[model samples]
Target chain A: MADKIFRVNMADLTTSIEDIPADWAGHGGRGLTSTIVSAEVEPTCHPLGQNNKLVFAPGLLSGTAAANSGRLSIGAKSPLTGTIKESNSGGTAAQLFAKAGCKALIVEGLPKADNWYSLALTPDGVTITEEKELIGQGNFAVVQALENRIEGKHGLLSIGQAGEMRLASANISIKDPDGSLRSCGRGGLGAVMGAKKIKFITVDPKDGKVAIAKPDAFKDANRIFAKALVDHPVSQALGQYGTNVLTNIINESGGFPTQNFTKGQFEGHESISGETMHDTIKERGGKVKHGCHQGCVIQCSQIYNDADGKKLTAGFEYESIWAMGADCCVDNLDHIAEADRIMDDIGIDTIETSVAMGVAMEAGVLPFGDGAGICKLLTEDITKGTGIGRIIGNGAGSVGRAFGITRVPVVKNQAIPAYDPRAIKGIGITYATSTQGADHTMGYTIATNILNVGGKVDPLTKEGQVELSRNLQIATAAIDSTGMCLFIAFAALDDEKCLPALVDLLNARFDLSLTGDDVVSLGQHILKTERAFNTAAGFTSADDRLPEFFYNEPLPPHNVVFDFSGEEIDTFWDF
Target chain B: MKISVKLFAYFRDNRFKIKEYDIDEGTTVGNIVDDLNIDREEVGVLMINSRHTNFDVHPVEKDILAIFPVIGGG
Candidate 1:
């Protein structure tokens, strides 16, 4: 392994390479990113301050051709929620970083100039280029410009105007195949990038291949994992239907957030469901499923098309559907598709943008289902940075506050995802206490063997939710550190051998023998470390909770309220 | 009494579309599972009146039941 760290100091436009920590070899990717951010960056520093650092690391199995293993984690203190944040994305960047023979990239210090610039990493070294010409360009345009300029095949991570303005809901876009925009679109990390005066980071690996320490064992483990994923029903559904498959299921369960979360079920879920998307793709002759990266076997991503069979977007996942569909009271799939394309181009968080629009409609700023009005508001008015556009850019919490809507569904200033916690109480717990606020990936309980951490509790029962959330959070932290996609949890839960096999593969590759228990312990430790950072940053148990509206309003279909007591919720992490 | 048994998604596509099963008084969800010839392990979420319920939970008369396979992802 190359024992080197690539460091970029924007203050002096200086770059250097240093030896990697001897202990960091086994802990590449998310493990390395989280550890470096937590240790090196001050927990209490302003998210956009010079004291903050953005660290990117690929996973332990990132370089190897492990299925769905090419994941890159961008970790720093989040501007949106003011918490420790790590957002993992899949594209070509992780694989490129691995091939570049570097474990991680640490971007430190704010730029001395007030102009836009970008850092390009290649086999030769790093170059700082003036990106002022690239300013005001959308994510796709910026990506194309960077690709053209870099003179080879490259992966570009760039932010749009939302990030430039330091909008709390800003996201960083990564290029997918056929040049569609996929993003790390949660937790305002793009604002942090904006603060650094860095418009984009382009990584190219002209070097032939990423060396693997144990190729045979890695291949065997990867094959087993691939087979398990292919055989799993959830994986099959995801591959076939994309994430929109959950639209009907969540609506049926009364957990699909609708009309700014005033109701749990949307009356028109079928119009925007996975089935509809699948049919649309078929009719339009679009690709139903494709990989986000080269070696991904799950292939849950899809190339969405217009009614006329023209390409509209790629990777139109469930959250985007929920945001534009039920949440905003727009059931027109084509309108939702257009909104998704706009979000991708603008480099913004779809969930936050949808929730903000919902709140705006509630405030009578625009009528519900006003897709054209929303399009104008986001694309045309937002660049002016005045009037309602400013409030919309601030995220769901800020918009809710501006509109005096107490029913705003958020935790730590970040809007909640598609799952309404009242209906799916297990996921609610995860949203409240997650290191990154209100995130579903923090603790995915979809297919896990419901660990009897609390008891056999009903989804509507509030009694055991805290403990459930806590347990899942710990498990998810460990999973994220592996640099593995959280979707693996579906197969890993039922196939008990998968987790052990993963650990075994890591151990063999890193020359260590780690037991399954040790893996669990590592997860716990990562959470504890994150929690300590949050605590020191002035987060109390009170901060670990869903918004107040959830406690009073009863969600539909089941009509259950979030009934967990404050004490029970507070005591959740005692374990 | 008879209750309607409906399977969705892969189950509907793969197995019998829909069927009416003659059930006894005080019949529970577990009994329905046994009667349908579906693997109990395959059922991840069971709903009656649009609320999630476990296998051991008893079904009420005239209850509209929907069974979903253990399918979930983000």
Candidate 2:
């Protein structure tokens, strides 16, 4: 297969092709997107403005038959967090993209008219076609329409009404192999696409393959990587119970982030626990341990169905459950599932919406634990983009601002995920300082603090957690760039061969001579690039700091406050 | 001595989610896991009085010992 670049100038609605530049040859997925944005885009430009460009690239091994290598990265200036952002997902689009011999797709400039368009990538080139029919449709309806229009097997990436209205927390939804959708869910990249007036991008490759430099070496490495994933207990657990398994564990640990961060434990946790969900799925004849994309041996995703055996949602992840359930005090899993479906259809970040729901409830907009109320809010209010709906769609930070509430648990204006910072103090440090706002995958010190996979870092010990978080963040940045699922970290931390196997895979694919040290350097370079961009965009250490409320209000279980001083948080930038 | 024990994730399988038992105050957290037939290797995090500790850590009066299997997500 051949490899080239597809650049779309949205200003004039023109498309062009260029050779894959030598400098960008080593990078892919998050790496390439960050590099390109740093080099080409203005850091200080308004995220919804013409100067901001949205870039999409497949992972390093995406097009190939590498296990768990189908995650696609979309990067741009975040309207939600005002930071350089890279959001990822697993879907059919990445594989088709890689197979088409396309290295990266960059959409730049802005359309003069307020018209929507869609791009189709075929064997020869990309075509920018204007579309009026698909403008206001939900993601599911849009995908069905696209499939009907194309009349063949293809991959899709489309946004919903939230994106069309340019909400700050809108996400880009990617079509999975099963015609279900997975999302690049964070940082409002969908709004960036909306600003460009692109409705969706379709990839229907006639025939193409990944350009492999050493197929034999890649195959050998693949065998090792695949085995490592299959042989891991964590992977097995994820396959069986899925990520929602954390409900009981985190609740038992007394760090569940209940009722909008007011408490750490949920009394109704058992109702929405993974074990309960697993039993319900089995009774309802839903498929469990399903892969969202090809070559995923772990299969942590699942298809959740209603009592009538009708599909409700796929890949009902832990963060979504936690945000929609415990954080909002909604114990009804079915209601949460419906909320998930609506969020998927509307193209909004679930974590942000969950936090916004909590804020809305706290502001007397709706009572907490009102499942029906939440469903109505999501369907009738948020989906239609009403006045108050606009605030919720914008994200937790905006909801808090609208209601004048101070307890919003957000960093860089992005809502924090499941874990409670006060319970795990290291997470507080991470939430306060991560380059991408309150993101756990950025560093995920939980591997050591909770799982004890890498090494023991006492969760309550400030010094150790800081050092542990720093090292993990560096390693994580590198892993995210490779298009590998972050779950590989469990195997990588335990089995010494895991990281080497991944490096070997990359080296074989690209014919590059890279060492373990190079990976570390690459991670550092990427973080530094992002940090520099945020700095130039007028972000200060003050923006990096968590709100003052976390310091004053001690969370239960540990009853520990977020005591990390400004100095400790600033140390995260030392690299 | 009265002490409380909480198990998390897969450890809850065939085990109570939270149970209280009367035992010697000097009992090690390792003894409790072993007594419950939980493999030391299977136990990921050990918290004594809500602080991180190892298997060798001995409990004091009213100490809440929480045992978590390798529960990893997000």
Model 2 CA deviation exceeding 4 Å by range: B1-4, B20-26, B59-64
TM-score of each: 0.93, 0.97
Clashes of 1: 1
lDDT for A372 (candidate 1) = 75
Instruction: Report residue A376 deviation for candidate 1 (angstroms).
Output: 2.3
Span of ten consecutive residues with least summed lDDT in model 2 chain A: A456-465
List each candidate's DockQ score: 0.39, 0.52
> For candidate 2, lDDT tens digit of each residue in A232-259?
8788888888998778767766777998
**lDDT of candidate model 2 versus the reference:** 0.87
- Give the lDDT of residue A501 in candidate 2: 90
lDDT of 1 by residue, A270-378 (tens): 7898877887998998899988888777788998899898998889999989988898899888888888888888889998888888888888889988877787888
